[model samples]
Target: MNILFDVGASGGALLHNASEMDIDLRNVDVIVISHGHYDHTGGLLDALKIINKPTAIIIHPDALALKYAIKPKFRLTGVPHTISEIKKHGGRFLVTHDSVFLTDSVATTGEIKRETDFEKTPEYYMLIRGGKVAQDKLLDDQALVINHEKGLIVITGCAHAGVVNTIRHAQKIFGRRDVYAVIGGFHLIGASDERIEKTVESLIEINPRIVGPCHCTGDKALKIISDNFAGKFTEVRVGTVLNL
Candidate 1:
């Protein structure tokens, strides 16, 4: 099945890329939103219009909740479009909070169970829970797992749930097996030096064949990760493609 992961920050670029790459957006079987963050969900409505059909969209229930950055200037950081807007454009929501498979081998991690001490969530982001505004644990943060013969390929989007924890969650569901690839944002931007160091070390321990960290992963962390992984590291970019 053709699957489109996270719509990106805007429609212009996404649509352009689809056309240029000869990707028929209309044929996308399903679209998965990594989380509620605007950058991850903003292009969804536009994409739905392209599909022009009742397309299934897999997402976390909490992804629809209002989100904000409490400090460094209060700002809305939640999904830019509403349910009504997306539905009007042909989105059929399949919301869930537990790991759900899209295929026999590919699935979403749902809410990652935090397992490490160093990996932490954004303390500045806040969200409404139980009718009270509180710290946004970003429980909606999730990853896509593709079980391969050699191991698993884990893809994450702004892993606010923590990279190590996210990988571990996938491991738990798929059985503790070798990870073939670990890609997507580590979300370590502006994180402490110690945290970055620890995260890189943990990634090395995971020993994935391909390490392509991008998006919100800070430059320092990326450099360290690439350095440590060496020949195994793959640079994630707009035109980058992986055979797996």
Candidate 2:
């Protein structure tokens, strides 16, 4: 049941980190790309080669679309590898917009539904559509859901779909509200204090047994979440592993 989720900024970094953790890339059963972001998918080709065998790579088709960060300056921020390249490197891609069950208790949320008004993906980029620049709805944003014995464990990448929405989507798919843990980027960077506060309150209602916000969760938001979650908050880092 070895699963790799969202490769890091570079393939070398992925390999280095795996080596540090004593993880053999060859044994990974599957690879899941949370979104098309460069940080998440840049190592795809290298990972595929490391596996060197037929492997299922789960991701959304929209992850291939041209993506950019328009602020400060327009910068490309999408997957660096081509679909053909991936296929040539022992990659069996499963691109879809529906839940994909890896196991009876493990699956992806597919396309998360944005139900909260305050929980919106910050305007980071304008995605190309019909040869025109359009607002990125990030419909491809999804998360992994694990039906643990205590409750569901949701893992996200960037969380452009909104963490609450991601969790709720997991709950809907799994038919449970009890979440054991949530560990990943919440994408609350540069968000308003009000939004961060509201998000923490919403999370309190969901009441995950453990909350580990990392990456794009933002420093300010992390402090707020830490303050609100208190005993339940866990500091996540590279090599940090959650048993549940």
Candidate 3:
């Protein structure tokens, strides 16, 4: 099985370009979205147009909404997708706010929950419902976990829910502590040095064989992982692929 990341950039890319990278789009049985950000979901239209066959599209429920915050004067800036538009291509689409099975050996950790007090989503956006603004808990932030014969490999997108928490949730869902590798964005662009250090410490315990940090993880954060976890670190780009 292969995990084809058609849309990984913050924006400005196409799912149709999979052919350019030598990825057989038809072989893809599943399409997993990390979050609701436009850059990630922007290529859905193109992808659905290409994959004419049945394919399961997985994402968090909160991602399908137009959300806003109060402290920031209740501005709406959420990317919400209509069910009709998602199914416009006449393909199978699976929606859920909890974990779902990808294959017999792989599963997607729906929304990584906040298990520790230190790990928290930024308090920037809030949901506006009935003229009431509430804390926007990104309950849709999820990751894909592959139970390989060697060990578990975690695939994440922006990781808005927190990378450490994402890993912990995968561990809880799989009931295993052996994470072979982790690839994708950690969303540490604007994080503090202390937070990054602690996060590194937490991940070090997992002893992942490969750590491919990309997208919004930022240069400084990636450098920290490179310097500290030298043996296992790798940089992720648009055309990166891994065999499982």
Candidate 4:
């Protein structure tokens, strides 16, 4: 199996090199959105138009809505694509609010439960509805787990759910902790020093074979992981592809 469709990555990562990468755009089987952010979802419109088959579009329902911050209140908006819109474009929409399997090899852990008490959600995240704070728990934040021949691989978008939480959920879902690798955004941008330290500690505890932090994982966090994990850490760019 292959990552037929990825996060709505902008700058035409796949769009510019679909053929060279040997990925058949017309045969894409699954499309997984990491979050509602445009940078990860912006390319779906064109991708959908190209895919001839009915591809499964997996996403959390809450992610399609608005996301907000509390401290000083700034806009970090979510993409404005509803399930209906996806269906209109012939997408096989898979709306998930809980852990579910999309296939034998591919499954989503729904919204990962914050298994660790130490890992706390950022305070700035808030759900506003009708000009009211909804205290959204981000129940739809999910990750894709692929059971490869080597070991289980976890692919995430932004990892709004704690990275530790995402891993634990993957372990539970697969009934094992033998993670071959984890790729994609860790969402550790702008994290405090303490948080970064804790995150590094947790990653070392898990000891994944490979950690490819891309997108929102800030440079400082990447450096810390590299300094600690060394050979295990690798850079993930738009054209980068990791095979299990």
TM-score of each: 0.97, 0.97, 0.87, 0.87
Q: Which regions of candidate 1 are displaced past 4 Å?
A: none
lDDT of 2 by residue, 20-97 (tens): 999899999999889988999988888888999999989987887888888879899888887889899998989899
Q: What is candidate 1's TM-score against the reference?
A: 0.97
Clash pairs detected, candidate 1: none
Ranked by TM-score from best down, the candidates are 1, 2, 3, 4
Any residue pairs clashing in model 3, and if so which?
68-126
> Which ranges in model 3 have alpha carbons more than 4 Å from their true place?
1-12, 68-77, 128-132
Q: Per-prediction RMSD in angstroms?
A: 1.1, 1.2, 2.8, 2.6
Evaluate model 2: give its lDDT: 0.90
Model 4 misses residue 80 by how many Å? 2.8
- Which segments of candidate 2 are over 4 A away from where they belong? 129-132
Off by over 4 Å in 4: 9-14, 17-22, 69-73, 128-133
